[model samples]
Target: MTQRFEYDVVVVGGGPAGSSAAYEAAKNGVKVALLEKEETIAETVRTSGVTWIQNIKEFGIPDDCFNPIRNFSFCSPNNEVTISDTVPRAAVLDVRKTYRWLAEQAKNQGADIFT
Candidate 1:
């Protein structure tokens, strides 16, 4: 037997964009189903993992989750420069935890998540 689902929106992928879409739609009382291809939502992270301090504050994400690097060093073929006092900023993240958390949040908001 083939199971067919009827939803207001069928969202593919469980990344940041997909999570946000599902969240917003579900929050509006729309039927949403989120699909993720990977078994583990947050497995691979290829990012340098650097984001601005203001973004973290705006997003309301806690500092404890990130590894704060106060200084940034840039190395180019021509030159290298290091800046100090990049306060309250972070560069490293546990991608696995973050992705899992996002998936959880979407689920909690009544969005059916499938992997």
Candidate 2:
């Protein structure tokens, strides 16, 4: 026999957007479910994982999940330049870990996550 489930809100995918939506909905007392096609959210990587440091701080991203990028380089046929800063303006994240963290947040908020 097949099992059936129902929810007030059903979110597709397990990416940041879906997880965030589910989390917020559940926090407001709505029954929410998040569906992910992947067997595991971190199994297949798809994101470039580059983001600003300000975003990291605002989102409360863990320090161990990302690498700070304090320098950047750009090159062209005739000109090339490299810029460096004492503090990191941006960072490169471990996409898998980030996604898992967001999903976990949603789950903790009472959102049912299905992978």
Cα-lDDT of candidate 2: 0.89
For each candidate, what TM-score against the reference? 0.80, 0.91
Task: Give per-residue CA lDDT, model 2, range 1-115, as digits (tens).
Answer: 9999989999999888888788789989999999999998777777799999899878777898899998899999999999999999899998889889988888988999898
CA lDDT of every candidate: 0.75, 0.89
RMSD (CA, angstroms), candidate 2: 1.4
The top-ranked prediction according to TM-score is 2
- TM-score for candidate 1, residues paired by index: 0.80
Taking the tens digit of each residue's C-alpha lDDT, what string does model 1 give over 1-115? 9998899999999876787788888878989999988886766555655666676566555566567678788999999999888464555655556556666777878899988
Q: When superposed on Cα atoms, how far off is each prediction in RMSD?
A: 2.3, 1.4
Q: For this target, which candidate reaches the highest lDDT against the unseen true structure?
A: 2
